[model samples]
Target: MRLFPHPFAALVVLVTLGAAAQTPSSPVGSVSPTTGLVLRDDVVRALIHESSGDRIHDGVQRLALLARDNAGGYTEAAVWTKAAAEAAGLKDVRLEPMKQGPQWRATRGELWVAGPQRYRVTSHADLPMSLAIKSGSFEGADLELVDVGTGTQDAEYAGKDLKGKVVLTRGHPSATLRRAVTKLGAVGVVSSYSTPPWNLPHRLDGDFPDQVGWAIVPPGLVPEGQPAPFLFMVSDRQGRELRAQLLTGPVKVDVHVATEEYPGHYGILSGVIPGTRAGEEVVLTAHLDHYKPGADDNASGSATLLELVRTYTTLIRQGVLPPPVRTLRVLWLPEFEGTREWFALHGADPVRRVAHFNFDMLGASLSRAHSRFLVSYTPDWNGSFVNAVSESTVAFMNRFNGVAYPPRKDFRIGSVTGSRDPLDAHLDRYSRGSDHQLFNDHGIPGVAFSTWPDDTYHTSGDRPELVDPTQLHRAAFAGLSSITVAAWAEGPGALDLARLVAVHGARRVAEDEFRARRDLASAPATGVAGMHRLARAVVRAAYQRERDALLSCVQLGAPAKAVRTMTQSLERAEAQALERLDADSKARGVSLKEPAPSEAERRARAFVPRRVKGQELASFDELVTRAAPEDQPRVATVQAALREATTALRERGEGELRFYQLPDALASYADGKRSVADIRDAAYAEYGHVFPVEALMDLFGLLERGGIMTTAR
Candidate 1:
């Protein structure tokens, strides 16, 4: 039966339920005066009490059984996902066909060392990851093993004959296969690129000493007219043993890989919870494809999404919660490829998509996997209030589940079955890896929920036993609460969200101010102007972010009074931040005003900036490689400088080293309508600082020389 008779009826029911759920003591829809947050006591209580970790665990267990090895596995996952969603009473459950690349499946594979003391190594029948994905079929063949440490560079294979041999290397399988097997005529490859240093002890001393991880053979990387080579990943322990044997004398091995490639469609399982609004929707997504027993990597995420569906369905059916005003759409698909295909088909009409919440690797056991839950924000290019909302929800959950100050205090809100360990989740800057990247690329604001530093990630050791049900429960709650509040936010709830944005904005401004001060203090006199420019730019970005948040509330149909109040609050905060920045500038004797560009600089600005399209643009590695022959000394200097800069940036909490300042920011401003000068000026307006004309010229010249940009006209 339908949950509501009509759209209007659904709206009325939601309003009525909101009114009924309120109480005098802790009103459900009341705004907290101190925190400026909506107190959704009823919804929080329901989520805490009704959400089931056991159900999440059961789903992960069932999914763990599926090998998910081929197109068949992908189809099987879709079928099961559809069935589960239907059983949960979700509406419009169906499988969407995604036509992308050919399907790859490993039917059988085995490896053994035959010479100088023979022994069995591993088999695909035992562990799917033993054979890398896209490995070709090969019968039993005795090939000598050659040690070519990280066979990616030509120097590594200078004096070696790798013909008809199995190359052993510690580099990525794809890179090694391309260089060793395809170029050097090796029969196969064995890679031992294990987990990071933190996970070394686990593999060395743990029960799964022979555990391996999955690798891929990229078709694009192979030499033209040469078929992809067979590859396998083995444990570091096994690899070490083989290398030791090779040290004494030549070691021969028998390798067999049975695999097939065929055409197949990617599957996307989707279930909808219809709401009062017809067009507007919020999507919850999780990838379902992975190696066999891929529990912590992705089975955990899929299971959490399934549990969320069941909980929402049950609550609505039981009359404990009303239907959302905006439709809630849950989707399961393969990772990047599937999401890309989905966008290719449905990207034209994305105006109704409120937000996309992506879940990946959300159930790793902290003690075993050394995992930390992370909620990554949307990129600055696609800034919205969604980041603030999601971050706030995670913080709220931490209050109850986070490490207590006094220790062992019962601070949890509602009774729920799971771990009492602190929620220890952190908010991270935007990164590109999973399905969320595709959404963000299509102009949709999205967030990704994941656990990092997982020792068992993407490895054979990522079994269902490594999943923590409590982690799953908490992740599901954060996602559900954020999306639910976003869908139903109006009146007091909308006001509270605006306030949340204001608070978050203030904190962000403070962080920028701190960074500016540090940069100014450390910069040399010659570089002081650039530093000041960057600091001003940071302030401008911060205020713009606040404005974006307030505008998002307006888009959400928030009450005018609430939006006005929030806008004024944001303006006041921005003004105060600017005043402080000016005061600091005066104290530092730095000029805030920019000088007018000379005629030469103005002429330089006339050059239109257009990003290069299509393939064959040289990669950074290729650039370094090509430069080595022309200018060895220059290359060494550049490399050393880069290393030093990287070290400094890492110390400053900037995880990745960026040699150029504001590459993405500059690129964002390089629309066809904007000239180089126009783009620079606009960037300055947005950032409150402009790079020196010479610096801008050098950046644009480099882009043009590298074929990454060109004159539009």
Candidate 2:
């Protein structure tokens, strides 16, 4: 039994009700004369000035003030905590406070570039050496300081007697020279640079030992009387002559810098919507603070949560939704630590909750501007129910809005989505990177709503004027729909009671299986093998027993819950196997290893399907012709999957690898627009058979990846 209905029938309803489905309306107002919603002129006018609209710059200013006024740049964080509490009007908006140590500490002498003699001497204020001087008896060590050209990877450093004395370097690669200098018995080295360019690539290896003086010296590295170091000035002719000469020369060295430490708190603001039923809870989440204005980066998400609360409250008041059967808790955490503390305090409720809906950076206009798409981040195939909800939300948006969005590319999602793959798949891909991570990590189905900045993300220029409010509305609508649907789906009496019980029971069984296989090391190999054999037999028997039941229910239209339960059961079986292996290995004081694959499994894993080249499947004649068969439900699923995959693949411009779509490969193949054969051929052409089916399945495994394509099977 499938939860999805027939495609032809669904398609008609979709076409006719597309606007209505995508854009929900207030009872007071109707859609425009053409398409989509039309707020009453008064209402539209009011929204223009609404605080919830797009007050990003204001929020950013607020953040800046908070950072500046508070100790350790955390007072701004406290302000956010307060704002979240005040916004919800909940005295106990789950305010949890935890301190984060100094984000950066300077230990070495400060290096500076005035006109650039490339100085390395000590500071006027008792500053440390720019480079730790180590002199091992040079015995008559008549030493002179030397200047290596700019420290670019290709910069030449060959023109000086750089032994037994100090050396000054130009840029980044200076640090790489420390050991070599030590080997050469050079007393010291100084790497210097002027004020940086507008943009700086985040270097992963920025930190170094304090002994080496990885410092920031002052503007007086060049003496007031002396000319600047050779090749320091950047006149056009100078640059050309230097380029021609590849200038390298001796330079006096001076080092100076001051360091300090400050303490601050990373706070998370949380609120709760008490539930009516026992043992059920739902959490709405977002992060409340950041280092920059973070408009689309996050100010949008924070604001989205604010508006969502209003909408949810309104919907509740209007009786559009039932009183929540489960507890509904909203959390505005200070990213990771705040979430961790909440989990510690609240215990395991997150995992046990009905679901979680997260709002983070919901107003990014770039996706829409460039691609007319809304992006979502959910868990990978190895994800859980929480992940499914995230994926489902995106699908709902697409279906309701009748808009095309990127398919769930595991690799792409994995990157901007943020969390490490394999280990963090179940957690918010962007969680550890942002705030949704803790809930997702605890097994609460969670999703991150973010609009990545096109040009301005964390910069000072992330002003409110740059934000697109219409896009915010779209994100809000999408988020609201997901929350509403999840509430209905997970709420008591929302679906057949028996089916829910079956789903829960089946999930437990799967967990039990996982625990078993996960502990294989604790049992004898023969017994473990026997248990696996029996497990498969049990699964076969269970399928046989339930197959007819499921098919009959489908034929009789028993209910949607039945399909959800059956699918859940299969998912559980797989989960159980993995868990069993993990648990067994742990019990035996050993770790479970990735299983050696047979040829078929290896081939399946190795395959990388070719995505549609240029045109969208909706635009392709063959796809339309293939899609014409409206009777088969699988066609819709396959087509939707291909549509998303193709769109995402194309969006990834050259010079960048697929990081978001992790474990990169085609997953399961069904003929929507492209057949399994076509996918296999594509993979053969692209990556060969080293790609595995499991990898592909994992890529497309969870529902969160589906975004708007949730209607697909």
Candidate 3:
């Protein structure tokens, strides 16, 4: 989808006009606490404008604006929070600063790439200043700027001694260049532009891995500053002219840089629209600040929260939602740190009843152009709640003006056993590039609204200019409706019932499938009777675990017996599988069973799994061999898809997918299948990771686009 910025002129005006004149409304069911009323529009506009206006727009701008004392200990973030609170008319806003670790400088200039194939450098500052040399030391090197025109790696730098020297040439680098660089023991490598103007300056910026000589030039030997190393470019006419001058002497250049650090804060800007119920609270959250302007990244989310607060406050004034069953709290946090602090201070128990509606980047439809929808990462246990909430929100959005509301393609449900799914963008290292990770981690029933990741990300260009006010309104309305309906629906009673039923059903399915498959596979005349029995045992064990997870998700009312039975079933299956495998190994006279548990399984059980990547998993053949060696070919196809699934996995790094499915992919693949490909494909197709091969390829391309993978071939 071609992502473009949505103009916010209308919403901006509405918000500005409302905040400046009207008095803010009191909490729901409360008397006239204050003798005034603030138009919801104005408050919304003011909050957005206050957070993202001018150079101080949406960033943790240093306290220079609010207070001039640079060394006064008040950080830009502190001042900004204070200002935001005052603008929202929040009471008792505090500017507390948390001491982050001291900053560490890049001790040496570096050329950092995804891996070691020194392809195109995409970062702005790091590339240009870095010299292209592989890891290891450069004792001494020298080479000339004679462009060998367009030719092979050997022909290009051949006849010329590049040993202990730098070589510069143009045209796409080949495996030969890789070998040449290795063979000649070249001290430096530089990619030069024969063209006149550099269109993308950011493309040329990167670090010189180990403080190597960093220079970019046309193919020419410029004048010398010393007995300089190699400097060259393409054999274009311009390069030839420069080399003629360079034979006289090689030019030398030196670059240096210093870095600075900012102390961070573990704080969030939060206010409560308290519910009439004493214990219940509903959370409407969006991250307040970011490292960049983060328009679609999260400014859109902050805006959504402000709009919802305004809408909810208005509802209270109109007595439409009097004395809500759960209090509504809006929080603008500093990602995980703020959330951790908040949870630590307030406790997560109250948040249990608290259904969360998180507004994240809802402006840019990254891949789903003019398309948006609610995503439910709930387990099968609370499938009902997931369904109701997702469906109701979409319905609400549709009612909010068909034009403003984009049609949702479908409800997306995912599971990674217990980690994030790779297909989800919000499950990244940053966890949806917002603060939703906290609530999801703590088992709170919540959903996040975010636009797809665009090109902006953490760059300076992620500004309000890209925001779509209408998109913002529609998403916020959907979020508000979901929360309101959930708040009014008593509690998790219905969901609990559904969970119980699903768990029971899943267990039945698992047992029936296990017995049927095992009996059939173990029939007397099977060709590979031993293998069949083992496969049956393995399949039964896998289903038992899957059913156990389903039970965990199932909301049972005092189904302790059912839960216990599920657990025992899984344990029994695991023990039997291990025993059978061990016996089979002993029968074959091979000590396949290490006596001790395999480290991978042990770690999978105890340690949380990290996200899977190309380097993280075994090779395709190895993976397939592990899954089902007897079905190697089919498995190889699947493994190829999985290895190429790097891009898909990365995309799913947003939101809750990173927390569950993405991490779980490793475990799913670790299932005792002899074929990694079969295991991956089966898990993906049967579970939720399935995608078209082309889609997988596209995703892989995105992840490895300009980056290189340095795996042992």
Candidate 4:
């Protein structure tokens, strides 16, 4: 449970390594595809060399062992992280507390079959993943094993009897339990669900037989008619073998689960590298809780953060990089619940909080997971220079790595003791589901860096060895470099950042406009008129996003006069782009006139959802808990609608997906000033959905009824 064995072993400090390499800049109007913001190249080189992958891996290996839910090892890890931060010489380090209502801790869980030979499928004593979180206590022997065939559906249980028995399911364990325990009288549940195998057949549960994906049963506060649910987890191989036995002959198993639920506080860890001035802050965050060996899901992000603190503190002390203009704070905390709770306490901090960078799953090997290191900009509705600056920053890795044509030098930044392979790094569009989403929802511009489609994601198969040391180094160098500039830029430095945002934002907006024009050409004859309105909306949306990005630079210290000059240019481009699109429409025989707001838009324009003071938003389950009994049914309906919007009703979905994220976006975008129509248009521009305003009313209605929000007409 100590965060590392010798946390300082991998702390490789930089020695004066010759004059720092100066990064050459572009022409007056041109920008480098890689690293648009010019800075002291010597300092950049020092950060790359000083950050040690071994150190990050060491911290991850240690943190992975302290795997418990909020009430147990997870809280202990927060204390440990605070100590580590203090040891690394960060200022104002503190372990902030948030309310964690009724936590679950599992002490005993085991699944074994007594057939011809006594065999244990798995045990919580050893793997810690054999038990699902929030499962109620239960003990039973010789329980008949019944195959429910993906127990997520009603018809799946029509002819089957599940009472006092253990049901085998490959469906989502929660979905399965919602059916079995609440309606079918099932006593215990076993799950082997994993993502379906894709190319290389990267089926985690199949490829790694002992890996257990995390699962949770219903909380103790279920409706009166429902029995408390308990769950036992097994890998795909075990589930398959058990089903085989059931098909041949009657199979029975023994199960014991000991769990306790108690009220506790979630820990939010914070520490900062003091800046030259007070009030302004550049924030960094990563979640610190997951299952054992939740390395890539979070430990990677958590561990690498220690490296950021180490590198930055050392560089400033050694005078390699100047102290930041704004205070730089790093936070390690429990994921969603903790973030929401923290925001409730400091949602309106008077200090001019600037931007946020969230790092998650940043240590996966590209070859193993077939993953690309992805960086997301702030959502277009809340655009900031983070997207443009970060895109240009990480491009350094992609362009400078491996061999190239024209016989250029390979300036790869790899670890001496880590994998030295070509990195599959890319810049991505805005994505949800990270700490950054919370910051953006709270009104700060934020970006998240991560790797996706990880092979061992959420499975016990994720271990320290699965993390590539070189990958950690890559993330630290790129992440630390961008944030340091954000926190440090002023005067000329701020101007450089503005220029970066202007050029990149222009290209990005142009790309969105091009797509709109392309879609316009293919609009159906009957829908051409509507398409014109849609195209105009797209142009207007693009203008807003890019304009926001340009404006964020002033916070970093860009001159107002210069920024105004740049805005005029963007306005001209916007007008010209719209004119060109209209000209193309005339050529295509659409001959459409500019349109006015439709009836739905008018309704949206008049209504807004206003937040109630100190009434913080929580997760779907917690929100249900807040509602009165009569309103609970409405909460349930809204929860389903929310799921369909963000997750397409399930983690995996059918057919083509539209802005299924409308459910997630509405609450975040309901910042009092935005009319329901403004929220809808932003959602349409960010995601390709032309939904009716009525589709979003259920959530606003629920929030207003719960006293968390008020709808103003």
Candidate 5:
């Protein structure tokens, strides 16, 4: 699990150099038709050679030293990042302040076992993660500890007093705090939550015993009238020890936590590498905020951004690389909250942002962290050719790095320094967890580069020593190459991108067809109509995606004639695919139309739902409770039924519900311009079937009650 490869491994790699160069097709230079940028052999060679893992490692180590739990930490990180950007010869480097409420910082924290022999447990002075984030100041002596397993549900608290006690649970700190402290009147909480073992890589052997990085909720973000409580995160080892002691007899702990909260601003550092075009840019982004010593969770990502900027700026300055035709802007943010604020403020600009390459948890060593480098795309629903470009770039790098061949036959064209291990990287489907989600939600094309199933994620065990420099280098190369190609892509490059999109779309359509066919085969007779409807809808969606990809080429300044020809060809291909699917449905005797709705259902469809802008769901819930007292019981009943149905489906081993589940797609269709019937048709077009007319009406009625929507008569 050490960060560095063994000396014997290094020796073996060195001895196999001759055999690594035998791949004759692995040429040094080639033109990328998609970007219209020639892959200069000397420049490519220099990029790989000059990208320094040491720089990335050192940057991570430096950032890891700052206490990043509050506004002060945010400020310090921004300062350091700005300095690094300036050093890299980047322009327009500055910190943009986001309007946020007071920040929380722990001044002091300590815990001690008082019963069965007094002994020290943990202290914030020694290790910051011992104190949960956002935990308020508290002092307690000889407080009894009560076990409330996974203390989120009401059943977990049954038969337990919990009052004035420190409740223990194997749940996320935030969830445990809400139940054990806010509801059950517990003075504090101790949680031993770890990432699920099943989700981890096989090589890790499920050995994640690290303290959680719990944070107290910020002032404005916290729910109205709820008191934030003190909480502590314990490693699994400590929790097990405490549990064993409790088995012997009653146990007590002495705890003291001194924390401060004050008004502060979220800091975002940004710089630009101006290109020939004034308005177009490709964004390179990573979040800079995390707990102290949060190396892999975010320091790795932030450091990788720094290293990439350094590499690009250095190359551009030395005249080894041409400046991109479009600007490359680098941004360091404060994760989701900060990203949301930034978008709200600055995202309405007329300037064209081509794409975003986001880095998060990008420096974990494959050997140490049991991680694979993942190039995660935006969801298929948020269709774009960005994923294809990223995949192609990573494929090239992997081949060059010998990831696809034996060590003896591996090409080390980009092996500047570190282990000769092939880039253990692959492309992953869209997943929502990081800042990239913000961009995707706003219709921006974004991709996330991350190391998945990080064992030390959000834990004290996430420290600088756990980061892998070689991994950082590979990530930088992947991100840099991708953005470089995107920023400079012109007519020929745009055509190349269009081709990739066409190929990718065809494959996606085939995959969807297969899934739909399998679903249809297993469906009940009553569900056959819905299955066919879904098939038609999926085909239409695929065609729309292909259309959007072709349109992007036009946006990228491709020749109109070429783009037009490509679009026409793609449209024809899509038509044929759709026709084939329709024929298959007919042969299977599947009906593709639904029965007409009743008069009552027609009335419901006439109702138009206009969403209440800027209202949070919780606020909307309260609004509904106040505005439609008569309908409250019905809404509650529906909510309970939905939850039960979801639980049953999950229990039956169905995967997580798709986006069209319940009211999600329905809500999106709730523009005032769309009637209830229109919305139903739209839903049918996208999902292949609509919710029952009554179900849709009930949802809209609830939305109306909550002021989330105003229905037209």
Candidate 6:
């Protein structure tokens, strides 16, 4: 039940197939804790089979063209998405617009190595990704090209005079800007960046020498009184060539970049399939924006979502599937910003929203990209039955889709247009990078289904042809299976779901209980009171989260009588978890009571923070820019701590936190009731890492100062 999320996609099929092979005479049904309804296995599989990789593959091709054309950007994709949704037979398809800062796009851009043997380096007309997004226009002729290796640290440019020069660095454009341009004097920027393992540290990048990364050059990145600079994103080979030239002699560079920023609105293309229950909804989301040929990054996500809309609506229309108990609303929107705006501005009621399933980068050539499909679920703080529901669904695939001839043996569903590669999927630890975070932040539990460590991630090589249809088919099938289950958590099916939740809830409770015991045993030298406090969080969180997951079934319209019965099961789970603590205390020969709050905890309890709308910070560096100069250093320290807490020390052979998840855990835990200390505790309980309370307060204070947060209503 506790499967690992690891780099090796090759897991023996025998483990999960054990149960799935024992097919029920009648296809097994999922019951809900509340409604006691049932959705038959045969019906669910039939609905999922409607997902066509062929259609998804074609969708990606069309979308890639729209993405490649800078003239259209996200709005263009939204327009296409609106039409696609309507054609797919989704009711009430529309493009919802949200106000946003001006959009930036490149018109014309070119870089050249000026000399006797003059040669053009790169151009926007040739490769649009060559120009970093939001880079301002600049024109310079025969300027010095300074080679500052990486340009991240001061030592990179310690004695070099970068004034009126193009600083060619193989670092992130933002880092180069922050250190080289913002602090040091540099006129122009060019980056030859490679993908590094940020979250899934165990994964490795392929030898993508020609891949040019998509980097950002936001406004205010440069110092005051400096010329607004332009950024060129060149391939690793191109950058190495330029760096070598600079080392040989004083290399002169000629550049001309033309770009424009216009007032743009974040567009979200959406449509809903009406359900038996009016207001209650199950939201399926996938981002639509990324650089050209971004097939794997998100065109694949958007395409697969389009297939879902098409498949589901068509099935229901044909009476092959009944109307869902809850409305199924599909969204194809820009990444983080669009999702946030929709949740904040649109009607968002946590009680009414049943679950959210976000698909990002679902398509990947398993062998080529060195990719594995990942199912990253909600943190325990957002405790909902969705985790158990999705987990079981994915676990089901771990068995159902296997290579075999014997009864209950390996089964694979392949498409002619798709690759024959096995569906390499795993249930990864929650690492947020897509639209699912907004749903969790809004208090509705969610999960993200995607692939990672992609060689073409955020690069020019993420082409449509490279996106495997078989992977897309598998992702679509797996995702649809979960979505359909959530959609129909009504009547007898709802009660069956409740049972499923109980099964998974018990697994989690047991895992947490074991962890609590382990924690206590690891610190045996401490006094009874100290020991009680140390294990208290783990034990308490386990019981608390599982209880909530069971109770969440009530949101799906479960009957009171059924819930009462389910509550008894929860009591059992709670009792089992408490037994571990009780046994530990008995062994220690001291009575254990909840430890009193420390000074930090007491301060955190009183200080409740609420997010302020309309003030969004993009990154840690951007957040630092908003803080007062003195507070900026504190923000920097917080950033450093956050980085350390999220990334695992792979050298120790430890597989713990995945870096990207920190922002979601920090952002989502700040509801009205939870104080700074409460959020901190939840984060620690969710992830084993201890994020300092002081560090959290520092970041929270900056959020408030930047108008992204306020202490209270």
TM-score of each: 0.82, 0.47, 0.45, 0.87, 0.81, 0.86
Candidate 6 lowest-lDDT run of ten: 402-411
As for candidate 1, its clashing pairs are 537-687
lDDT of 4 by residue, 1-713 (tens): 86765645444222223233332221112243333445555555677788888889888888888774546888878877888888887888888777757787888888889767779888888878768777778888888888887886677788888888888897778777877766677787889875532312345346766667777675643675444677878888888888888888988888878887788877889888888778899989999988887888798999888989998888776767767789988889888776777787777777887899898999888778667788877777787878877877776667666432313332456765667667767776666767888788777888888877577877787788888888888888778767877788777677777888888888888888987897788887667777776777788889888888888888777897898788889999999988987887777775475467677567768879877766535433456567787776666666665555544323333211222233555566676887877776666666655555665665676767767677765
Write down the worst ten-residue block by lDDT for model 3.
30-39
* Deviation in Å, model 6, residue 364 alpha carbon: 1.3
What would the TM-score be for candidate 3 when compared with the true structure? 0.45
Question: How well is each residue in 1-713 modelled by candidate 6, as lDDT tens digits?
Answer: 74875534445455456644543332226552322323465565565467788889998998887653343677778888888888988888888777756677778899999999999999887777788877778888999988888776778887898887888988767788777666666877888885654623533333567888787776677655654678898888899899788778999989998888777676778889888777788999988878887888788888988888888877766556767778888888778867877866675354388799999998888778887878886777777878887777666665555442213322355566877665557776566667776677666778998887676777788898888887888888877778877887665566677788877777877877777677676664445665555466776777677768877877676665787787787777676667767777778766555467777667777888876544332344456656778786877778788767745434434343355646535766665677887777677666766677878877777766766677863
Runs off by more than 4 Å, candidate 5: 1-46, 152-162, 172-179, 196-207, 210-228, 401-421, 521-526, 590-593, 597-713
Show how many residue pairs clash in every candidate, following the order shown: 1, 70, 79, 1, 6, 28
TM-score of 2: 0.47
- Overall local distance difference test of candidate 6: 0.73
**1-713, model 2: which lDDT tens digit per residue?**
98888999899888888754443333222322321222233322222223233333344335433322123344456566466546644435645566555342233333332234343233312322222221111112223545555544334444444565555454542342543253344554444432222212211122211111122222233345432121111122222332343245423333332333456455556665554456666677766655344455456666666666665554554444445545566776655555666666675443356456667655544433221233333332113333333343344334333422224221011112111211111112321234444444443545666553234433333445555665565566556544543443332223232342244335444543443444343456545543443344333333332333332223212356656567566656655555554454445543234346566455543433332211111112223333434323543444455545444543543111122221222332222343333344334222212233333343332221322112122
Give candidate 1 misplaced runs (Cα > 4 Å): 1-28, 33-39, 115-117, 152-159, 196-209, 221-227, 404-418, 590-648, 656-713
Q: How far is candidate 1 from the true structure (C-alpha RMSD, Å)?
A: 6.9
lDDT of each: 0.70, 0.40, 0.40, 0.74, 0.70, 0.73
Q: Best TM-score goes to which candidate? A: 4
Expressed as tens digits, the lDDT of each residue in 426-479 for candidate 3 is 211122224554454444555667654243433333446544444454455456
In model 2, which regions exceed 4 Å deviation?
A: 1-52, 55-61, 64-71, 99-258, 262-264, 314-323, 337-351, 367-374, 380-441, 457-463, 488-493, 496-561, 564-713
lDDT of 5: 0.70
